[model samples]
Target: MTTVPQPLTLRAWRGRRVLALLCAVAFLDFVDASITNVALPHIMSDLGFSVQSLQWVPSAYLLTYGGFMLLGGRLADLLGRRDVLLAGTVLLGLSSLAGGLATNTGLFVAARLVQGLGAALMLPAALSTLTTSFTTSKDRHSALGVWAAVAGLASAVGILLGGVLTEGLGWRWVMFVNPIACVLVIPAVLALLPRDLPAARTARFDLLGSVVVTGGTLLLVYALIKAPDQGWGATRTWLELAGAAVLLGSFVLIERSARDPILPLNIFRVPGLAAANLTGLIGFAGMLSMFYFLTLYMQTVLGYSAIAAGAAYLPLTVGVGIGAGIGAKLLTKVGSRAVICTGALVAAAGLFLLSQVPVDGGYLGHILPGLLLVAFGVGPVFVGVTSAANAGVGPSRAGLAAAILNSSQQIGGALGLAIFSAVGAARTHHLLATGGSASIATTSGLGYALGAGAAVTVAAALVALATVNTREGESPMNKPERVLIVGRSPSVLVDAVDILRADGYTANATNQFDRVLDDYDVTDLDVLVFGGMVPADIKEQLRAKVDALNPQVTFVQGLGGIAGLIAAQVRAATSQETQDGVSYDEEKREVRLTLDTPATVTVEAWWGTSFTPPEPKSASMRVFDGQLDAGSHAVPLPEEVPAVASFVAVTVDSATQVFTVGAMPTAVTQLAPASANDNRLPEVGQVTT
Candidate 1:
């Protein structure tokens, strides 16, 4: 009997095997998608198709893949993920077989379209599987890092592999190869994937949403693709653009109203996730656009053969793979923000370098460094971006979040290519007007396109930098450990953290121990410092969840009450004072009071205010020096005779004392920082004796 693998202790071999299966699945997903690009020319030659008709072979697949991803994600959520995945695999296999055996161009195009639908289904299901399987943040980031690396490498690998297969065997091998690959995944998936449960909760399908978003994306892609051929201002172009706008607008409205939307609008409210998706979209768009033109420039303009052109992309593959692997390690070091921002900026630099290439520039001097830089930049960026985007999203919305991120990449790719090409066309026109040669015109246009790509990535970097957080608060430092403070005083929790930290424990500060046991993911935690509030039920539930996630989480319980616990382990560190003898640490920790004796000092509150007496027509005196004066002076200083019993009515600069008083304190009042008269005070609210 097969059951979906829940959180449990599993054999190490089983986990490794499952991970290997997923890696293979990811490789197939990427390789299968890109391989067709290599076979396009061959397919056209055999079927007697024109360039115009042949373009659809790739475009159709990309369009369908982008347009239906949201629907595919919803399907995975509604249907059992494994069931959808297996179905997609079957369809993918069948579609590949049909595409390979196509006798006519139309049949082949139809097969490609079907293949895309299968891919649409497979991509989300595969991503969701990883999310569902890897519950911990660390594991998820690792999984995505591997996924990003494979996706990056697969692009270069596809062209190389596709060319080899197409040339050595036949163009048909391009299509036939996928099904053969699919066969390997099927067995592993069947063996490793737990049985799918019939979905306990079913969502109503968003038919209107499906139509609008798909139609909008299709129209938008078409208009962009058409713009290079059709004039930018052409009536047909604007009409399609307008249609896209209306449809996309309608899609947003539909999503907002739908009881269970295919695309959840609420997910955007998550700051990290939203920023990640936006950055990914822009970065991917820039990358895809760069590739589209670079490929054309290499083959069409520079006269590189198909095999050589494919091989030339090696630098990018190496760069991205290295960058992504580095990102995984750096995630723990600098956090996601620094790594992602750095990657985006580096990628932009690469694009800028590429933009500097002249018309007749060679690959070594002109392109190699740029390509390598971009490759290095992109890999890490994707890893960090994806990790940040999916961070802390609950399990239920994992598929939806992943779908959004991937969709942004796809949509951005299409849009980037379209917009970049359009910009290139305008640049080419400007070059022609300036009496430049055709070669110069083309190169100029290409440079402008690359420039635009660089700009997009730079913008992405800025956005990520502004929005992403590097704090790893989900760890023990953010959540307090439950240490039982034995004494009656409530200072036990504070003391326990100090003691735990001193005692070599990764303890977080938690005010309420009763809630910490339930909310925090303490599966891998060691030494849970127990307080007196620890109930057997709470302990049992925590132990169960911990054992399920990871059994090594240790539990350490403290024995005494609050004050008693504080005395046993560690004494609290005193607040450090500045050179002016003023302590800045107002961390709202345990309350303590100290009296000031005839000392002139400025006391500032959180916002900076002063305190003074409420009387007027009194003699002015510098109590610290015991110097009495009849008139007021701007350089007045106050010192308490004995101790100021005045309340913390106000605060001032560090130079100003809280109050000046006789042996017995008089009335105390708070004053604003700007108050000139010591006799005036602000309104009093609460009185604490």
Candidate 2:
């Protein structure tokens, strides 16, 4: 098996700029999510909002961000990725401008809500672009490593920039910053990245399915967010949670009947996928809560100013960047399970250590060490899980898998923060009720949250240990090469796809040969097969087009009707290097073959100046080994062959019948096996000694 992928050379992929643009967008997302928190108080005061209502500023963004995320990913796949990405970017930029300039709570909150929807659209498109842009694992690993580091750094920088903007340029600048960056990004995108291919002509949006899924996810996120304050046992909370479950169940039913489901029910079947998503959820739950409680402790108990608290995280940010670098390096060397478990243990230790913070603890003595540990563990977990989550899903659904994993992390963060905060608050309340000092109670509560987060990280490590395999954890060859089958009937093509996929090829099919270029990408294409039912003229046109487009693409003429025969033709086209059972008869104008192995082999006969085409006449076929299992078999050519045409069958060079080494035959002829007395042997071992 091919293990290592070719290096992602920028000159070839033109990916350096693409990676930069995607990273910029991701950074904006992380920064915007964190930046608003620092300025929440300012907005609350200015808009005359109460404490409960103030939560909406952040919740509004999270609500739609998580709610519309899956839909956005499906849209990226169905619609052109560039189109969705641009739409999202424009919406986000406009929303940011609106939020920055708003004078009242309603307008600001509305802007924030739109921002979430925009993010829902933007993030998946960006991630899918990143996923599809680099086809090789080494390239992907290198790219994701960079992206992982950027994400870690961006979250930290967001807090730092949040404080700077809130203190220096006023809180509105925090909202304004996105638009300024957008101004630079819009043109950069147009100039840097090529426009995405046009959307498939037959693609459907699954509107009803989208509505059900969006509603389910939104309700789910809302319930999780409010459960802490609403009380988990509250009738309202239970009703909301139950409603979400019902809608999700409804989504499953809807998908079974939908012509094209937005999120395919079958994607969950990908190996290691469930565990990867679970790891993401558990990992984010711990790390995000750690950030939250640490910030709270700094601002409330340690009596640090907002800026000072933000600046204090600098070392943690550096540590995470360093850790991410380390993780990327280790992922290939020691494998994902080892790295994930090790990182988690180190992080858990840090969180546990931080849990012992004294009421009067300082940053250096108490906080920095824990932050370093969390950073160390978090980097590898995110990097490893990101790869693990996406393994073997194929390019068609890359966006969906990316969206799902991201959604899990977002929900995990929200849920973890809620659970930990609620527990800590209750503990603090209980301590104060018992007459504990205010500082001690606050410190103790923060410590409790951190400790819980540590426990969660440990759980994430366990999942990785259980589910991750050496290949997924160690190398970048996560997805197989893709095949595109063009035929006359959709059903026939779909059946072919199933067979090819079952046998380990990442395959897709389309009935319209004219739309092959639009329906699927040729970048990662391994084989392009024209079905027997497709028009000769259409095949000629498309084959010529593909030939000019990607000369390395193996072209096979599907000279057979059945799905199994078509799949066999594809198999032969891809595995010719080891095959040696075919030859062509010039006078007979036919293909001849012998089968020693009981396997289906597809063969191509070329006739021209050379045995390979660019020849004048050629024939392709699938030969079933069962029909000729007892002995050598001969395959006759099509009757329509011109009497004058020559033929050449091809296979790799292989040794013919064996003969005695001591004597060379002056003339060779086929004959019955030699009589027992005629067998050659070395006389007395031909001993020299």
Candidate 3:
């Protein structure tokens, strides 16, 4: 007989140890990106690199890292996460050593590229390991929260460390530091992480898909990186972009026929996956451009030394930690939708504030506020978006899911940099043509670019509001079928019911437990929650009555106020089987409905506080007036529904079921209502099984 592995608890020593090791790996990856920014001047002076060729030092790493991420993730699935992680760590150590010892530009650039490859491999593997090891929603959320904090903190810390190291030890030590960190990490990973399961020898690799996808991504990223310098309208830029398009199109065709594709297109069918990735892309684009432009502004306009500029980011770092901590806690109470949307809006506001900085702006008044706002706003976004992207993904494709999320950031940063660079350059040239001073022209141009970045962040917020689910505490898979809250206090009962209902539960509460026993049917309820204020004999009697009605009904005692009730609900929900096969599409404003058999399904849309389906006579909107055969069908939704609709009811014959629709991707502008006589056909789309 086989035994299932138990979910890791908060106090588990092994879980915490593994999480620490994973976070170290994540920190190293992000730190490496920013550390080189401060050391670039020293590297150029020491290696005799021309200003024109110096960009390759950073571009080489970014190109290879982004290009190979999809391939690396697929490899982790084919081989094993632990094996890939160990191999990647060794490669990173060797590359760091090579970079430190390099005396020539070519060697150093090559080492950087190799380091990026190692990072691509290790990052996905580490994320997949974390996802697989945690198993439970609570632990996974907490672990990913720490990982998000590390990612944000490392970037700021990297700049500070780079400035200190370059000024004191030299640039070589900057390259050598990673190898030393890896040496310490390797031992802990081996001891703390579980060994990978044996792989099947007969498994085939998708070499064709891998080649096309990697080559395509590399060309695309390279084009985006060079577009600002080459000019967007330049022939070389257009040609490279066209070539990338061709290669990527070929990859899609190959994936359709391949035995094992590098990236299965079906993953897009996951609820909120596509929207989450788009949100990540837009958010990162704004964030990365902000960082890039600000660094230049500090050095050129503000006349700040590298060390001073690095130190100035201290407030931003602290703000990120504070935001991430609050986000993690809020995720359990409110949900990812609320936290992510709020964060993106705040970040946009911060970017807009930064855009208002004048040519002679002061650091404390103009720069600090913007930096703090952006940092705090983006902190929660990273955590919430990451959780949403990876939720419900199986272990087999966990690495692929993580890779997709990371790739969005890379691609978004590249695109944002390219577009904003062009925008700024165009604006500056126009100002110069109109007889403005160079200083005024430059500052004005940067302000316009920052405004564009703010717009992009706003777009991200809209995506989150539309597509992300409003889940609290546990995931949908971990929610109970039904919950009954029994209590004496009306306030406590109301609060508990509200919390549970917000979490997508079929929850009901009553102050009169004995009255409920006589009037309501208790057979269908999965959980019986008793308040702490309830008498012991009364609770025992209620439990006996519930047990007599349904032996499967779980009795949870010692409930305090709202928090305790939520906690009990989570525990009960985690042990129960959950509803599946329902997904929402934000772009088309539709629900991909799946049925077990051919039936004439009536999907009634509702906008109200309660998640429960109203009586057949009470439904206001009959959104999808069609029959869906077995499989999946994209049913059109009500266009003029409120910004946040509570739920939709699917009625087949006499059976009616309610599904949450509040998390569907929302539009910035409210859509106009369709006319009654309008015969516009619903645009059909595929949903992968």
Candidate 4:
């Protein structure tokens, strides 16, 4: 007999604290990645390094961090996540100690590479641990939510914490602090993580795949780094770029044929994964560059203290947390596609706002708007992307999906920073050659950098718009009962199924859209409401399909947006026949008139209260009323029309007639006979804004 797997017991499952520990570990990993930024000045001064060499500090770290991400992700799967986590933590501590106590530039750069490797390992392993621990869909989603929140906020918090540590205790502490954090968390992690063994799968390591991908990543990063120093056309730059192309091409080919792929080609077929990954790449590319440029601006140009700069970024961090929380709450209701696309577009808008920041711009006007917009844009994106990537993933492969997503962010950020820095530096050089002031050139360069970032974000928007395929704002099961009526409020139609289910109409109400199509035998679907539907091609197609399948089905065009129809009513009430109502402002010498008709009409102004109507009026209004004037004769209304200070409302009434005038003050078109009956006007209801 096969032994049944033991189910989780309540007391033995310390999953909650294990999750918390992983989050903290991920936070520490990112902290070391960016912490040196705030301490760059002190480092440069202590080492007596040139600006050129100083730049390498960031570049070297970014290069290795991005280059090794895929490899690290693969390692997480091959080795047990628990073992990788412990090893990574030890590597982090040792690297921190070495980096903090470095005496020479060579020693320092070597230590940074070590730190990047440690971070690369810790990040994927931490993510794998969190993802693998959750078994059920609901639990997995919840776990991802917390995981994404921590991941999103880590960079911002890293800088802030780095700033405080660097300021209070000196630059060495920035590097030293993580080891302390790691030591504090490791024991708790050891206790809380489950002791379950990893499955002994026969998957082999993809060394060829790793080498090609890593080589490509390194070459791409090398091209970026070199482009800033060497001209873009430089032989070294072209060689590196060409090498990157070849390596990446090879990587793709190998992955397809590999028995055990490092990067699975099949995950791209998942509905949400491809879209989410695409958007995440674009977002990280644009956003990470902004941080690099902004950091330079704040410290080098604005001369902000390290601590002060960190404090200034707090608003953005807080906004991101709040935005993510709000997005998480709304995802179940709004659906994934709408939220992700919207988030990408919103992020592009934020980048646009940020690009407008001038050399002398104020923080309140230029920076704050951009910061808030970026925060709001990024928040939903984090949650939506995380959810989408892992939406249908099995427990065994969830870690792989998470790794791909994480790698996208890391690689995108690295590439974005490198490209934008080159742009900024190039622009600065161009301005300086023209004899511009150093400060002016610096700011102008920042503008170009940010502009490039905005452009990449726009590309991201296009990706999101094109590739994100999930339906927006749909309930899971739309129809649950048979013989249902649809000629009611859309919400009411939705509610009917729920009510009927409670009343035992059928097998319970459903919100799944596809189930509605399948179970009802489209021919048997008794009713449909047209007016409640949005004027969308998808809805139209669905309607056509149902109509074609079941021609006998009844359809009811339940009126929707009645208030808009009434607003159309108010617009139609302003046309005049012969004598047009006009208001004049003597001080401004302006006169305007409104006319009544559904047809487009134009109004002519002659700087007088009364003037002959032009054959073709420049402006016109619409009126949905009982009737329009019978002929071309102007009929004045007794009621005082709602008039703007310089405009007057006009009304005409008859059984039914419409008249148009031309530029020569002659009638353009007129109905020969009026309709026999008038449409009665309904009583006005309260208007909603």
Pick the lDDT winner: 3
lDDT tens digits, residues 526-645, model 4? Answer: 444333333455457767888898886555432221211211122232112343443333333223233444322222111012223332111122222233222222222212222321
Cα misplacement distance, residue 52 of candidate 4 (Å):
1.0
User: For residues 483-601, could you state the per-residue lDDT of candidate 3 as single tens digits?
Assistant: 77776644345444434443445566676756768755689878877765667898888888889989988777622233222333344344433225556665666666677776665
Q: Is candidate 1 or candidate 3 better by TM-score?
A: 3
TM-score of each: 0.68, 0.74, 0.71, 0.65
Local accuracy of candidate 1 as per-residue lDDT tens digits, 1-689: 11123331123566556666766766776666577776777888998789767777777777777777766766776676777778888888999899899899888888877877787777777777675565444565666777788777877788778777877899899899989988988988999878554321323566777778878877776776676677778999899889999999998988776755666675665557778888888888887677667776776678776677778888777877888898877886788888888998898999999988886778999889999988888888878877787765543455666677777888888778878988898999998999998888998899899999999998888888755553333442222332222111122343333333323233343435355545455655544444434466766765565567766544444322322222222211111121232222223211122324232222211111123423111111111112222222122112221222221111111122222122222221121111111111222222111
Off by over 4 Å in 4: 1-15, 135-139, 466-689
lDDT values of the candidates? 0.62, 0.69, 0.73, 0.59
Write down the worst ten-residue block by lDDT for model 1.
669-678
Sort all candidates by lDDT, best to worst.
3, 2, 1, 4
In terms of lDDT, the poorest run of 10 residues in model 4 is: 670-679
Q: For all the candidates, what are their Cα RMSDs to the real structure?
A: 15.4, 14.0, 14.8, 22.4
| Pick by TM-score: 1 or 2, better one | 2
Model 2, range 292-399, lDDT digits (tens) per residue? Answer: 688778888888776887898898788788888888777667766677778778888889888889888998888888888888877777667776776665445667
Regions more than 4 Å wrong, model 3: 1-6, 198-202, 433-435, 473-689
RMSD (CA, angstroms), candidate 4: 22.4
Give me the candidate number with maximum TM-score. 2
